[model samples]
Target: MPAKKTKPTWTDVKKNLASFDNPGLIALLHDLYTASKDNQAFLHTRFGLGDDVLKPYKATLTRWLWPNWLKNQNTSVTTAKKAIADYKKAVGQPDGLAELMVFYCEQAAAFSSDVGLDDESYYDALVRMFEQALKTIAALPEQQRPALWTRLDQVRRLGHQVGYGISTSMDELLIEYGVDARRSR
Candidate 1:
């Protein structure tokens, strides 16, 4: 009779890693970075290891998310949404995706504040971005959510202070996320 074969697990891999010294671990990571484009991109972006943080990603997202670049962009919101989706898919981490989402909203909020774009429609796209970000949270462990929530709240506070309108306020969306908003007097 042939012996049964089983797949190795992450725990098994982690256990194996304990035998390596610092140089060995670094060498392993080097090998992983060389093994695949996805691994290289993940490490580069996560650690900002590249000459440009956006070097690991498609330029579409960097152009859409950054203010100086996005200011001159003629792209549609759908294109921006697709850029984010592509980034998230490539990175394979919800936390990374959430960071991109928050970064976009923060840029949009600043743009809105600068031009005083009407709160209602101006923040509509941002709300959609927020909603999409919310979708990604389900893939993350519970403990990781609070930081994301805090960043989202920061955007909301910025919008509220800028007088964009009640629709753009943080409480309504936070409620949807099951987080009670702490109102300021």
Candidate 2:
């Protein structure tokens, strides 16, 4: 009887990613390229990417946004700090403060992309960075997690408003994400 084949392990996955000249990498790149092309086509067809009508206010939205949203919420500062620090470490940063800076930068880039200020490559890069930042933010303690998640939702809502003229209010955005903004505050 033939032996059953085991699934590829995490080490195998890492090795695959490390093989820069591998055919698998070429296939993965092609998949990503095609997906990006499809995404751009959809955006252009549905949202009219050329029109710079609604510009999202990213700076004001991100400034103290986390703290402000977290204020009056039930969260331990120690846990929040520790989670931020861990996230920084995971992402190869020196400290949580630096991670916060990177997070804000990614948010700013997302805003720029939503506003049609970024080219296809830049926009795609920013979106990937934003997703990484979001994953880092999600590793926070449950009590302290709402603040960062709320800020992210607000950013997405603002992006939607800019891109699609969808008037998604802060409260509505929070509700949509199942985050009780009132409780979070």
Candidate 3:
């Protein structure tokens, strides 16, 4: 009988990597850096090498969340959210994560408002990310909180323009976070 074939795992790859010397590892890293834009972004973010490490991640978010409908582009919340997850995995800086989350909320809300998207699932995802942005921003330092809050406040206004009770949901979240919805308006 033929032997069964199995998928290779990270452990298998790591075991293989255990044999490499420093120069070999550097060569492998160079190969990875040149292999793909994603690899380059990950390496840049991991080492804090770029002038704006978040730029690639933001571009991914913009592409997935706020696509150009005239060009037949489609939105993918999963892909947009994956960019945030990828950034988190690269460094998980709290302020950076908050920025990306707020930016995610902003892109999604703006798209919904502009397109008049009537998808229930999309609104649900937007509201969820709104709440998440609030949570993440709330955990940041008091000084850091203001700018993110202002951005989310803009998102809340966009939600109102979206016209699916998204603004109401965001208002409730703002109240829960002690932001005073009436004051935020």
Candidate 4:
């Protein structure tokens, strides 16, 4: 009987990588960076070498969350969420992660408001992201918390306009976090 072939895993890849010289590794990374924009973004983010590391991630979120209707673009919560996951993998900086999450909620809410979206799943995603943003923001320093919370407050207002109990759920989450969502600021 023929032996079964095993698929290559990270261990195999790491062993191969360990054999490469500095120049060889550089060449391999160059090839990978050239192979895809995602790789380029990942490299730039991992090294903190870009003026705005979050730009590519934000563009992806905007594309998936607030697709151009007239251009026949389609919304994709999964793809939008994937951009956040990718950013997390590259750097996972708390401020950057919070910014991306808040931006996601903003874009999704804006799309729902502008397009009058009636999809329950979309609203559910928006609400879930809102809570996630709140939770992430809570972990940041006190000085950073105010601005992010203010932005989420704007998202909550947009949710009210969207209906489907989005605003109600947001209010409850804010209370759970001890936040005065309607406070004068």
Best by lDDT: 4
Native-referenced Cα lDDT, model 3: 0.89
Error (Å) of candidate 4 at residue 155 is 0.4
Task: Tell me the TM-score of model 2.
Answer: 0.34
Clashing pairs in 2: none
CA lDDT scores, all candidates in order: 0.65, 0.45, 0.89, 0.93
Worst lDDT run of 10 residues, candidate 3, spans 176-185
lDDT of 2: 0.45
Candidate 1 is scored at a TM of: 0.56
Candidate 4 contains a number of clashing pairs equal to: 0
Greater TM-score among 1 and 2 belongs to 1
lDDT of 2 by residue, 1-185 (tens): 99997998998888868967678777775676578643333334234354521111122224322233335532122333333343334333322433453455345444454444424443343344345545554455666666666555555555564443222433343454466544654
Give candidate 3's root-mean-square deviation (CA, Å): 1.9
The model with the greater TM-score, 2 or 3, is 3
Could you tell me the lDDT of residue 105 within candidate 1? 73
Whole-structure CA lDDT of model 4: 0.93
Ranking by TM-score: 4, 3, 1, 2
Provide the clashing-pair count of each candidate structure: 1, 0, 0, 0
Find the 10 residues in a row with the least total lDDT in model 1: 176-185
**Lowest lDDT 10-residue stretch of candidate 2:** 52-61
